[model samples]
Target: MLQALTILSLLFLTDFTMAASEDPAELGAGLQNPGYEELPAWFKTSFLDLTEDVAEAAAEDKRVLLYFYQDGCPYCAKLLRDNFTDREIVELTRQGFDVIAINLWGDREVTGLDGKTTTEKKLATLLGVQFTPTLLFLDEAGKVVLRLNGYLPPHRFAAALRYVAERHERTGERFSEFYVRTNPREAEGDLHQEAGFLAPPLRLGDNRRKSPRPLVVMLEQPVCRECDELHQDVLRREAVALSLAAFDAAIVDVFSREPLQTPDGRETTGRDWAAELGIEYTPSLVFYDTQGREVFRTEGYLKAFHVQGALDYVATGAYRWQPSFQRYLSARREALAERGIQIDIMR
Candidate 1:
């Protein structure tokens, strides 16, 4: 089954080397001795000139893919090792786009599409790059047509590539819509039900005015393997369940046209609201504060630990002071370690 394969792949991802060492001589030869992130050799060696890079790729009748990464990021390693090694994905990438890597915290100078000059880190900030492996797919005009905020496994990542490569956005169809229409997977037959979720005839705006708890809108599809795992494995954990207790949770089928009141009091269908929120990944958990403002969200495939962390991050009102989820995760892990508990992200 796909769910079994997904879990199996995640287990292998835990073996990535994170030890500190000098950068490898040949990047992307698999995880070399060095601990630093290794990009695929096929990634374009560029001068970080966005304007020129776009033009050059356009000349070759290809689009541009800007890969933003950080050193020692496990997901980035998974992307390079797992996704890039797929012959189909590699060939599709080579045929359609010029892939360029940009270090999220590097000091290398970069020229922006707006003709402004900035360092890699500064440009990342300017572009609101909050997660590693954030991919920006640009059109010939240097406009980002699609932006992926975190790592996606090969299947979804390939769909993303094809979406941009075929210029689906030019037809006025969002990537999320296109993906749903093209790729339909087998599921457990129905949406997973949770006791914590709000009852139907869902009026989120009205509920927010009555309850003081934060709200979490889970956007999922019936035909999703990850969604099945989320409900079957991740949510069943005690810590994860406890964290879920702090919020008023709601689950919506992203492809459904069923009407519901949004947290901001807008009447819209689940399908429309999902497209508005850019819900590209199934089983995306979007968290909002008590006042109806978005605080944080997790859109990638994550295990129980990270899921619990995201819940605690919002439930504890930590986002008020800590804007960086990665930093908060680090501090959370260290705090747990002091109590003689070792947390594994893939677990």
Candidate 2:
């Protein structure tokens, strides 16, 4: 029954996507006009001073949602029309946080948390706002607690609000963990197949070809929405598709009983191994170094930019130098921008 509902949902969404129009205004039942900069009145009217905004939100006992969007971005429209327009979501936002919209390409002055003034575009660049509809949930101290890089459907978006509103991160559980442990959404996309992915009978311990790259074990399940998003948006990117060649990637169904040699050379069923590893989410990428030692892993729904960054991080061996993945990605984005290369971050 769950699977059937998931498939129906997918079909519904597919039809909606296929019926898009060239004119942005005509796209969402004429709910949006392209180039219009108006935002929800509930969104705080700030002096564009992030420090003050954060302080005010803190005083009100609320988190701050920094929404970075552009005028014509379809994902932004979905977020605005499909998600934000929902009365329940609006009320939830009002209760939990003070939402602020920042135009990614606007010239409006913004005083950042560092007490420095910059244009909205410059501030977005500084904060790595590579994708429209990026939502940064900030703590009282102005530190980013959670970052949503793309448009999430209503359920997942609501889950994110609850996660941050309830301060789940303070419990030392990752958002993916919290999400899975709480209200799991119905599946969105099916498990994606790629030619580069290793075929079944996956003996991950054996590298007879002596490949110098690391091993990436993708633990996923069929009809996983997060998994679908990864294949649809992230893995198809030229950079990520190319970067994947640097690693020996394998996918294992978390619920399957298929036997395989683990990275530590232990023979176990996929289900058993996933249980041992506590892989609570589909589309989780567990990176293992050349010697089969666990290096890094991302266990949640991530946008193309973040997913690609993970690939680059493991392939280029940057994880060894930078303790913070976010910091490394910032430096990487800055370097690419300085090189005059355009980044389609949400691709």
Candidate 3:
């Protein structure tokens, strides 16, 4: 009877150990296994070059939460498996912040404000981060809003997010105001103020030859939230604006009665032209080659880097030699990656 009891106990213990090992969420008190369903709607998984972009986002009322992690960092993995994967935290992050994950030991290069370049590991050291899983919160102007060292529990992390969000809601007060009040700077000009607009108007088609460069028609509606966001945020930047100046650009309001001539020689009002283009969204970029042939079209908002890549692809005719647009995009990414410039693929 004793031998039988011992055998049964051993079997039960083995089974329990196997179950726990298989379940990542059960491995620890706070840790939870991640799944696609658990990912926050607003948590952008798209990889982006966060170095310069963070500053620009601050100007647009977007705060950046930058997570520095390495491959074998258990704490970093725990945060991903537990805190970030939590449904509530994911939802909250989606609503409030633009999150970026950086490999701290990565070999990627980052450009500094003074035009100097350094590796990701070197940059981490310069930022005074001594450990993995450091979270740096920056306003749209690239000012450090908060810095959290070591692992943060889900509850405390949520609280930190709330604190930042509440502080950000006070519009009249700039990030510089709060930062300078606490840590005074000798510099007079606001760093946040220098964060320029993303998109600007084209030079009204100066590059037009007997064969024009290309025509990029933007379909916009007055009160469209996405349209307004793109116009004010992505398109207003100097780089984007200058690139756009090389093309014949026009913004047509969908409700307008202004006449437009289609590539097919058919004349119609701007409203009808929008309908013919099958543009259901307020902000859509329709690209036409020199001969007025539709090369490509992208609907919705795009960030600066992706937008730049897309423009470069179409302008240089890179698509003609590539297998597909997707492949071309991959090649572009690899090229940029080689130069240590990361671009958000989602955009």
Best-first order by lDDT? 1, 2, 3
Q: Return the lDDT, model 3, position 244.
A: 71
The lDDT per prediction is 0.83, 0.79, 0.62
| Model 1 CA lDDT for position 292 | 79
Q: What's the C-alpha lDDT at position 88 in model 3? A: 48
lDDT of 3 by residue, 1-347 (tens): 99999999999867654442233434487664332112223454533556555655565566788777764467776576446644346656766678866556555666643456786677788888877789988765566777888887655666667657666535666544545444421211111111232123222223233435777777665534455456667777787777776666667665456665664456677667876786655567777787667888777456676676667777878767763766777887898899999866655
Top model by TM-score, which number?
A: 1
The total of clashing pairs for model 3 equals 11
- Model 2 scores a C-alpha lDDT of 0.79
**Which model, 1 or 3, shows the larger lDDT?**
1
Q: What is the lDDT of residue 234 in candidate 3?
A: 71
Q: After aligning candidate 1 to the native by TM-score, how far in Å is the CA of 122 from where it should be?
A: 50
- Model 3 error, position 159 (Å): 24
Error of 3 at 184 (Å): 33
For model 1, the stretches where C-alpha displacement exceeds 4 angstroms are 1-186
Off by over 4 Å in 2: 1-190, 342-347
